[model samples]
Target chain A: MRVLGVDPGLTRCGVGVVEGVPGRPCTLVAYYVVHTDPEDELPLRLLHLDRSLTDLVAEHRPDAVAVERVFSQHNVRTVMGTAQASGIAVLAGARAGLPVQTYTPSEVKAAVTGSGQADKAQMTMMVTRLLRLPEPPRPADAADALALAICHVWRGGTRSKLAAAAERARGGRTR
Target chain B: MRVLGVDPGLTRCGVGVVEGVPGRPCTLVAYYVVHTDPEDELPLRLLHLDRSLTDLVAEHRPDAVAVERVFSQHNVRTVMGTAQASGIAVLAGARAGLPVQTYTPSEVKAAVTGSGQADKAQMTMMVTRLLRLPEPPRPADAADALALAICHVWRGGTRSKLAAAAERARGGRTR
Candidate 1:
């Protein structure tokens, strides 16, 4: 399955596309950052982000979209911007008729680096090794986006398998 | 000027349209609530909201859009949802090339009721009286939305006047 992951932010939104099956190495389809000027008005900034994300989704055409869930932080203003950006990202996926999922930062870190508390360097290293890239992805946001996509692909696969197995078990009991 | 006011929420978004100039009783053109099932997935709920707000803007063709500025609250989850909803509302206005302005709850209260700390009942009462409506607008959200629109109209007018006065003073001094 191919998945698009978004690490949503107003100033810099990271987007990464990955193609792979569960329990296998993933291939990097593409990755980029969408930037908006902080000096611009809030509405204009949001509009630019919405359009950029819409175009990105159309170009990649991933099977599913995954976004990093925004959490409240001590910096209220920054968190608000992040939440707004993530909202636009989720709308982009839904508008394209694709299933969208959100994972916490820890979830992505655990999925990619085998530890929920892994540091940025560790996540970047793991992502580089897993994707067999010669160099690590620049900007921690990009690495986080890749981690989110990888997490969704693996978790989505496992969830479906578990559901199927449960159904089979129930059928056998009924029979 | 005609203004569209949005009090953004995920479950029930309040929208109100008003037409009038500053220093005059505003006329309420329309007011309604957009509802979304809370049980529905986040993306679907947001998509429904986006479409509803978009359609409302297109139909009303307001000169400006006013939205309540979301603030951080004790309930982090609710605040996040509010921020997200407000983001979509702002996008609706920006996409339509209308000037969008956000006013804090206190600002709206001060503009309508002459007190920043006015309670919900006071706000509703003042809005009804200001618009010359026979009854109070239902569902506190609707009243708050109307207050936002009223606030924008008056504030926008006053702000421009202040700018022009400052410009004239500067021109005189420079000459």
Candidate 2:
């Protein structure tokens, strides 16, 4: 399965694409970050985000999209921007007619590093190893996007398999 | 000028359309609320919000769009939802190439009630009076939206006139 993962932000949004299915390793297709100027008007900035993401979706043509779910207890300064950026990501996916999946930070960390509380260094290392990268991706955001891509593949794969099995069972029996 | 004001929320989004210029009395064209099931998935709920808001914009063809700006130092449980909803509202406006304006709670209250700290009852009364409604709009969300519409008409009208004056001055300058 091909998946495009978005690490949403107002200033720096990370985009990563991964290709693979269950029982096999995934390869990173491309990873990059799109930046929007803080000085720009809010609507213009969001429009830039939407346009850039639409371009990215067109270029990658991934089968599905994964977005990092945003939650914060602190981050008073960043929370609103992050949440708004995330909404833009979801809207981009919806516009592209892709099934957008969201994974929490803990879920992504656990899926990649086998620990929900994995530190940034650990996450970087694990994501690098998973994709067999030459070096850890720069600026953590790209790595997080890769982790989101990885987590969604595994989790969504399981869900799809279960759904198929249930369909089969239902087909074999009376409704 | 016509303005469509959106009071954004995940569970209940309020929409109101008003028509008139700043000096003249603004009349309410329509007001309503769209509710999403709390049990619905986030993506689906957002799609509902987007679709409904898009239809509203299409129906009203407002000259501009207004959205309630979200802020939270407390109210943790609802902050993210509100921010996301507000983001969707702005996105809808941006998609339609409409100028999207935002107002804080205090700004709206001050614009409508001439008091930054007006209470909810006061807000309702002011919106009812401003709209020249037969009775106060049902539910606080709808009233809040009407208040937003009125605020934008008064505020945005001044901004547009200023912009026109600036353009005229620029046009007169030597190239």
Candidate 3:
């Protein structure tokens, strides 16, 4: 399966794509971060994000998309900005007809580092090891995005099974 | 003086330009909303926004930019999307070499309605009355954007003075 992982932010977004068959390890195909000039108008920044993401999708053509889910935070401004970025990712994936999935920070950590509370450095180290890369990914955001992709690959099947079970439970109740 | 007002959002951004003269009412020069297909990727959306805003700026040549300051709420997804959109607006204004100003929703409402808690309909009516438009501006976001421009025209100087004073106070304390 080919998977694209995203770490969404208002000012910058990290993206990574991996491709692999069912029995083999996924290999990194591409990765980059989209940045908006901090001083630019909000609309223009979003425009840059939109254009860059579309180009990435078209070029990479991943079969599935994975994104980080936004959780509640104390900083209202920060939370708001993160949410906006997440929305863009979702919209992009939906538009491309890719099956989009979301993972929490804890889930990503647990999957990548064998612990739900793995720090950034640990996550980064684990991602490099898992991907069998000669060097770690540059820019912390990009590393986090790669780890998120790994998490999706590891947990995606279980997640689908749980979702199916929940759906069946609801259906049974209705009938 | 000319002011461009922007209401930034994920799918659409509303823009309005007004020319301000000392001791005279601001004149509406142009107004329009830019939109992106939700199905497109983030990069494509950003490109559409960038092209449209660049064109608008080149055509109208506003001297300054006024944008709404987003306040975060419960919806994490929505807030992040808005922030990305806001970033686009900021980048566009900076590219045009315009000094960008931001107004809180309360400030815009207060400037137009003499009440900070004014509803959208109330604010829209006031904006239409102030601009002497034949009808209310189409799209509530557009009207809110115009209100932001008007707010800047009415209170920008005072706000700047307050900001300067606050800066001076910080400088004195540091010394």
Candidate 4:
């Protein structure tokens, strides 16, 4: 299955697309970051994001999408902007009829790095190793997006295998 | 000056464009809600947002953009999604080289309704009244975005005027 992962941000949003089935390792198809100017008005900034994201979607044509859930702190202003960015990602996925899934930061980290508390650098290294990329994905956000996709693959695969096993057992009993 | 307001969301991102200068009532130039499907993959969703927003910006070239600043809460998942949406708005504005400004929800309500505690209905009523619209802007999100733009006009105008006056005073004395 093809999966696209996203790390949404106001100034810079990361996107990664990978293709693979449930049981096999995935191949990195594409990855990039969408950036906007800090000084521009919010509407225009959102416009830029809308266009860039649309382009990425049309190009990659992934079957599913995964995004990192936001984790907010004391900065209300920052959190709000981040939320807007995330909304765009979700909306885009919905419009295209793709199954969108969200994962928390810790869950994504643990799935990729085998540790929930892994830092940015660690996650980047792990993503690189797992994908067998020649070089680490530039911009931490892109790497994070890739990791989220990997996590989805791992979890999705496990679930499907279990389901298949149950089906086989039921068939044997009937025979 | 023209101001564009955005109420960023994952499913329906409301956008309102208005034209006005300091001390002048703003005119609604255009307004619409951009939507994306929730089922699509994250990257495709973002791509849709980017394309739609870019079209909106191109159709209506506003001088300034105003957006609501996100406030923090206990819900980590909600906060994260909101932040992502906000980030897209910021980036879109920056890419277009428009001056982007952010306002807190309370600040916007206070400016429009003369009370920070005003609820959505009250705020919508006030926004319609202030803009001289026949009815409140359709969809709560659009009204909220329009209110944000009005707030910026009311507040940002005064600040700019004062700065200009100060600059003139200094220039006169020096000359």
* Best-fitting candidate, scored by TM-score: 2
The numbered model that scores best in DockQ is 1
lDDT of each prediction vs. the true structure? 0.88, 0.85, 0.76, 0.75
Per-candidate RMSD, Å: 5.5, 3.7, 8.6, 8.3
Candidate 2 colliding pairs:
A1-A20
Q: Interface Cα RMSD for all candidates? A: 0.8, 1.2, 5.9, 5.4
| Poorest lDDT segment (10 consecutive residues) of candidate 1 chain A | A166-175
Candidate 4 structure lDDT: 0.75
Candidate 3 per-residue lDDT, tens place, A45-69, comes to 5556766776788888877778898
Candidate 1 lDDT over residue span B28-80, tens digit each = 99998998888777998999999999999999999889999887874776888
Q: Could you give candidate 1's per-residue lDDT for residues A1-175 as a string of tens digits?
A: 8899999999999999999998989999888888889977798899989998899899999988999989887477698889889999999999998878889888888899889999999999999998898999988788888888889888965664575598788883221
Model 3 spans > 4 angstroms off: A1-77, A81-122, A133-142, A148-175, B37-43, B74-77, B157-175
Badly placed stretches (over 4 Å) of model 4 are: A74-77, A157-175, B1-67, B73-102, B113-175
Give the poorly placed runs of model 1, Cα more than 4 Å off.
A157-175, B157-175
Which candidate has the top score in lDDT? 1
lDDT tens readout by residue for model 3, B33-151: 88888876565575567668778888888877787877775255666557657766766776676667778889889987999999989999988988889999999888988888888
Worst 10 residues of 2 chain B by lDDT: B166-175
**For each candidate, how many residue pairs have backbone atoms clashing (under 3 Å)?**
0, 1, 38, 58
- What lDDT tens digits, residue by residue, belong to model 2 across residues A49-142? 8888889998999878889888867488988888888988887887787778888888888888899999999999988998999999998889
Question: Which candidate, 1 or 3, would have the higher lDDT against the true structure?
Answer: 1
